[model samples]
Target: MYGTAAHNTYAQNNVGIESPTRLIEMLYEGVLRFNAQAKKSIKDGDIEKKVYWINRSIAIITELLITLDKTQGDISLYLEGLYNYEITLLTNASVDGDVAKIDEVSNVFKGLLEAWRESTNVA
Candidate 1:
């Protein structure tokens, strides 16, 4: 409980202090980190941890999907499809214990993270 509270506080602080672009980059980084954990959990035969991490990744993706500005036109539409595909891959990986599926999602996010950093000049 203390750990979670501390982590939440840290995240809240970041939200308050960080630029919006940096926050999005952090979210992408988070998904990749969670995907790595989920993949490791599958390899270790730890079903509970696998599901937990995969669910975390899915939640982040869902948040990103929902927060997208559809008013941006084609980019938002493209991202909606891409994020949905990532969520589907994460869900399937959770059920099938397929590390490759996790890898697929990770690959996408890594590219997105780099692109985000470059485009946003975040860092």
Candidate 2:
């Protein structure tokens, strides 16, 4: 327990020290990872695991959507729409066990992640 607590504290500090660009990159990567897990769960016929991971992916997309800065202009608006659509896809995937929906969301995030890295020089 003590080691776990210390590790968590260290993890928090590590995340806290990153630039905002790096943080966004991490979120994008997290969504991708969760989407993949959700897709796998769907394929394996594990409804519970599918819902869990899809919800996780949706949660991250919600965070991204809510944090969009309108001051960034049209790009922010575009991202808002994109994130909302991704959430919808994930939600539908959760309900229907549709790996295609998950795949669509994954592709969007993968593109976003690549573009984000290139634009922000985060890597």
Candidate 3:
């Protein structure tokens, strides 16, 4: 546990060591978090905040795709393909107002993150 924490701390300190897979996983998690916040904001009657999270979620997916392409030529390409599918799902979820899709994406990303952490020895 300490080792994992230490590795996470190390990764936080050194962004250079972050892989595309890690970035995509982080973005996936962020989408869930931000969307939840957006939902709350909507419930609280704040249209702006709702839009904020929606836009943020979209931005994260967009950036993930671009970053994946830029980070190409390693294990990144495979990861990119996986995320591309996730991104498509996310896009559909956004359009269809399907909260369940987010959960599905979250599950898929959790698996991806686990594999990435094991292979890279990252936390």
Across residues 1-123, which tens digit of lDDT does each residue of candidate 1 receive? 999999999979879998778889989999999999998999999999999999999999999999999999999999999999999988989999999999999999999999998897776
Candidate order by decreasing TM-score: 1, 2, 3
Top TM-score model:
1
Tens-digit lDDT string for candidate 2 (6-75): 9999979989999899889989999999999998898899999999999999999999999999999999
Better of 1 and 2 by TM-score: 1
- Kindly give the stretch of ten consecutive residues in candidate 2 with the minimal lDDT sum: 114-123
Residue 49 deviation, candidate 1, in Å? 0.3
Candidate 2 clash pair list: none
Backbone clashes in model 2: 0
Model 3, 1-123: lDDT tens digits are 999999988878765676666665676677768767756765677766656776787677667667665455766777677667777766675555566765677677667667767777776
- Score residue 35 of candidate 3 by CA lDDT: 66
lDDT, candidate 2, residue 105? 96
Model 1 earns a TM-score of 0.95
Q: Which stretches of candidate 1 lie over 4 Å from their true place?
A: none
Candidate 2 lDDT (Cα, whole model)? 0.92
